[model samples]
Target: MPIGVVKTERSIVGVACLIHKDWTLRDEKIMVVNLNIGSELLCLVIANGPNENERAEIQDEFYEALQRELDKVKGKFILLGDLNGR
Candidate 1:
């Protein structure tokens, strides 16, 4: 699965994750965006997790990876996307 973010003109003051390789999982299932909004910092995460049909191990790995990203965020954040879980 792929992920992305769309922002209005001049809405984002700066992008902290410029390198895709550093912010996204190897399978491209998760995308982390650290945005500079005015005087505040926001961590925006878009994730596509393994569906119910997928192997349990794969699902576990996805959640673990997601947790790792969340742990790295220090301030205000928003996580929105298809987790693929029931």
Candidate 2:
């Protein structure tokens, strides 16, 4: 199905997916920027969620989660986030 500006808000907030005319996958930290692009797809995997956490303890869990989400991606994708900056 086609998708739009699907977003989720909470401790971790972001656009779930911006499907101009299609939907494929989405969950928690798994954000599908474009479900399909001719034959490729783009996704932003978030583990720490956001930079507004304010907490100084968030590494192991974040990295672990990030790796897990990345594994779920099928073919093509991209990951965005500040590691040391956080």
Candidate 3:
């Protein structure tokens, strides 16, 4: 699985995310994200594996989605995540 998230705040920024990769023969991808408006925090997660092709695709898709989400926020922002795009 692959995921990415971003957060924004008035004076501070907080971003969080995760990524998991497998070492098996088969390939799989998983992605997740969480946005906490009250806490002013964004969480992202990325889990991918088995090969480089799948990793690259996950990374590409993640960035695309991440950027789109970031555009909706304002003020100081933080972007963080573990994108297993290896």
Judging by lDDT against the true structure, name the best candidate.
1
For candidate 3, lDDT tens digit of each residue in 1-60? 221222332212122233243212111233334456585754443333223455667557
Q: Report model 3's TM-score to 2 decimal places.
A: 0.34
Candidate 3: lDDT over CA atoms?
0.40
> Candidate 3, residue 73: CA error in Å?
1.2
Better of 1 and 2 by lDDT: 1
Which has the greatest TM-score? 1
For all candidates in order, the CA lDDT equals 0.67, 0.49, 0.40
Query: Which parts of model 1 are misplaced by more than 4 Å?
Result: 1-27
lDDT tens digits by residue: candidate 2, 1-86: 22233344343333344346543345444343435567667655533253545464654555566677677777777665444433
Q: Write down the worst ten-residue block by lDDT for model 3.
A: 19-28
Model 1 agreement with the true structure over 1-86: per-residue lDDT tens digits: 22233344332222233444435433456777767779998878877677788898988998998898888889998987778744
Please give the clash total of every predicted structure, in order: 0, 0, 10
Residue clash pairs of candidate 2 = none
Candidates' TM-scores? Answer: 0.67, 0.47, 0.34
**Which regions of candidate 2 are displaced past 4 Å?**
1-34, 46-57
Scored by lDDT, model 1 comes in at 0.67
